[model samples]
Target: MNEIVTTRLKPVSANLSRHKGVRRHAAIFIAPALAVYLLIVIAPSIGTLWISFTKWKGIGDEAKFVGIDNYKQLWNNDTFRGSFGRTLTLLIAGGFVVFLFAFIFTMLIREMRSKKLIRAIVFFPNVVPPVALAIAWGVLLAPRNGLLNEFLELVGLTSQTRTWLGPDLLFRSIIAGLVWIYTGFFVTILMAGVDRIPAYYYEAAELEGASARQKFTRVTLPLTWDVLSVAAVLWVILAIKTFEFIYAFGGSGTDPSASSWTLPVHVYVVALGNRSPILALGQGSAIAVVMVALVGALIFLTRRVMRRAVVEF
Candidate 1:
């Protein structure tokens, strides 16, 4: 009887030891990722929040507590206000155009021969560095010697060869470029969603004598909605990260005109592009804090609005 009890205790002890070993290895694996996330993301964000409430030059100067002065300044400034408005236009107006073109192209290309090649061509812009594309955009619209201007001149539509880079049209030009760059990514996402849809749905719709538009509305739209929701969230995130295109937009070494400035560009302009450089670290940090808050709120709102009952086949 004593031998039997000893053997049972041995297995129990081994099981407990195994459980402890598993937990130890799990911590060992998770430790590095947690450390990096805290150091790189969370720590910097917290530091920025603190810096926003103070007047620090981000260098050797000591931070001076200013309470809410930076926030007030940011609000009172007309340029900052305009920059935020432009940011919204980019997020909403540009988003609408991107999704519209993406859906149209997805439908057109889905039935075409050589679709793989067409898809590759459409997706090429996303793969290229946005800086290169932006520079190319500037050259293509370069006031007088631009490709479009030259074409208009060649075609005797010389009156239409207006200054594309001037203040009047610069902001719209930026929006158009953004729409073009982002549309491809959404197209790919939407097409993948379309692919997952069963062909039987379409066949049944056809047997019912459903019109083309009817099939799209009754079948395609409902089935692919889950993907659309995900795509919408991604678009908001991508639109917020619209710095590189706008930064490289005004050509090399030139500051973007006030009309074309978005929130991210405004942040950089305040922090580094000032004639008295490094003077407004606190102000810039405040702008950054606002951007963070807005992004979080919009993402939450978008997720809520886009939520739908899952339509699994």
Candidate 2:
């Protein structure tokens, strides 16, 4: 009896020792990455949080502890309010339009013989520098002698030609440009998800007399819910941080109008724009903190809303 007990104990002890050795090796491999993350991401975030509570210009100025006054000022600033509202518009309305067009394009090109070429054309804008795209858009929408206005005149619809970059229309134009830029990227993602779905599922549905719309609703959408959720989260982050496109869209050598500013642009305007003599680094930090918080909250809400049972194939 004693010899049998010792034989079983030996294997158990060896297995436990091997498991510990594997964990030790894993920890060794993870240490460098963990250290870098703490140094780069965690450290800066904490510093920014600290700076948000103080009033400070850029280097050479002493930081004054203000106890949330920066946030209070931000709350009262009309320009900040407008920028925040525009940011939300870009996040919500822009996301809706982008996904809408992405779905449409994906459905259209999914079965096309020339789908690769079409996809490459659509995704070309994403590879181009956003600043360059914005400049091109600005030229196209210029109040006079612009290509769009010229085309309108040629088509005998001169009345439809107005200053596309005017204050009344600049934000709308930016939103439209954003939709055009991002739709292709989302289409690529959704197309990948759609492609993974077995063709037999659609065949099965068709045999049951399912129409095109019905197949899409009952088959495609359900299988791709996880991908769509991730894409939505990615859009939220991208939309909030958008800056260069809007900044350059206003034309060179001058700041964009306050009406077109998003939160990221607002941070630049507050902390470093030529319009201000002294930088409001503290206020900018406050804005950054708010943006981080907003991103976190929205991501949490999105995950909650999109949570569903895994539909395994």
Highest lDDT model number: 2
lDDT per residue, candidate 1, 200-249, as tens digits?
Answer: 89899999999989988999899999998889888888888678889889
lDDT tens digits by residue: candidate 2, 279-304:
88899999999999999999999999
> What does the lDDT read for residue 284 in candidate 1?
91
Go through the candidates in order and give the C-alpha RMSD of each one to the true structure. 6.2, 4.6
The local distance difference test score of model 1 is: 0.87
- Residue 259, candidate 2: alpha-carbon lDDT: 76
Name the top TM-score candidate.
2
Off by over 4 Å in 1: 1-20, 274-278
